[model samples]
Target: MTILSDIPRLLPEGMALGPALDRALAILERAGFSAVIYDYTPVPRSHDGSLITPNILEARRVPEDMLALWKSGFYQLDPVQDAALATAAPFVWSGLGKQSRVMDEVIRERHRPVLGYMHDMRFSFGVTVPIHQPRGDLATFTAIRIDAEPDFAADAAEIVPQIGVLGQIFHDVVSAGFDAETRRTHHVRLTPRERECLSLCADGLTAKEIARRIERSVPTVTLHLNAASRKLGARNRFQAVARAAHYRLIEAAPAA
Candidate 1:
């Protein structure tokens, strides 16, 4: 018997990214989901605070019409996707019963068609695992249960938390398709100096302190920080530090 936690080890070795994603969907199907949506973004947000097109998006068992409409930009308006972005934890939601998530938060008139399509298709009950990569990329794995009863979420609770490990492993497989340099650079690139500055900043050092530690001018330290911030798509140096830590470009500051 295969344990749900073993989904990663069960994945086929050396497959292409498309085939790998399909294999992941198949694995989830075996886990009892009727449908699955996998979306990955190398850059998930802009400095302007808007959704960017995901670098990779795939779905299994979604109707073509709705998938087309969603691909045409409505995917950004997905409340479930939005909920996934709000946290790194896995969760379950339903379109029925005592509404577990804020369904209408981003729902506007233009999304009505997609909503109607989902209603028509019964793609309601769902469990989602949000994978936050060490490099700051984000991916979501959603398993949808077609026409599931209101008790679906309750039943899923037994398995949902463990399912997160599946998403984590599958994301690694899908991410393997890209060139190593491309993933390392396009996702977020930093020079040794820039990375050092950000690391110091995250360690609660001021720019002047960073300059003194590195034996550089304060302006030079500021320059490296500003450049790192720009490369990281951060609004400011502090945000750059946080983003760098999130990317594991720098370790978390030891607790005081």
Candidate 2:
């Protein structure tokens, strides 16, 4: 098995995302995976109310036709993608349970075409690691062993966690390679004061109430809230609170 003792070595100085991803995929290949795919969705606030496009950060051993089909909207029907968006944990594709009887019926009947296409591609078994950034971006790294051996499931069970680590490492490297604008779009860091203000706002507190609770002057509280709003790309205090909650920078609701 390929032991990635030094994952940092996979991406040396000046290496681009493509070559870095290739090296990462090679590590997975050495560990028995036949293919790997990495997907990244930028923080939604950057979209300005437009559609957010998911990027295929890296892929190896996927067929051109399959890629084409996915790009043509077949990904919307993918249960794995659905699961990744909903959870921030590593999972085996085969381990996913149907959301409900209605959703199961929808998957079997409404998404039959996509399911059939996937079946035809011979990608029957895989492990996926879902990465959820604090800024509301979702990414998934998947390693697939197409020609499954008897031990495929067992191997996946053992290696899924390692794959999850690889996913985070890959995301870090890829994120580092992004241009300044791209990085700004994906990662937004809020200060402690900003987060506190937003959390209080989520509790439906007025600016004066938040100031009193935090023992700061109203002007200071307002400044923190304004800074947070700008950083979160929100238009006002309410929008800032909403965006902060969406990014998990602050709680969506206060404790009882």
Cand. 2 TM to true fold: 0.62
Candidate 1 worst ten-residue window by lDDT: 95-104
> How would you encode candidate 2's per-residue C-alpha lDDT over 103-184 as one tens digit per residue?
3433445466665665676665677888887766777788877766666667666777788888888787777666634533
Worst 10-residue lDDT window for candidate 2 reads 94-103
> Which residue pairs in candidate 2 have backbone atoms (N, alpha carbon, C) closer than 3 angstroms, thus clashing?
none
Question: How many angstroms is residue 22 displaced in model 1 relative to the true structure, after the best TM-score fit?
Answer: 3.2
Per model, state how many residue pairs clash: 0, 0
Question: What lDDT does each candidate get?
Answer: 0.71, 0.70
lDDT of 1 by residue, 1-256 (tens): 2326455466745556667667766776665678777877766765455565565678877777766766677776666676677777887766543445544454457556555666678876777888887666778887788887666667666777766777777677766776644343234768889989998898889999999999999999999999999988889888998777655566655787
> For all the candidates, what are their Cα RMSDs to the real structure?
6.4, 8.2
Clashing pairs in 1: none
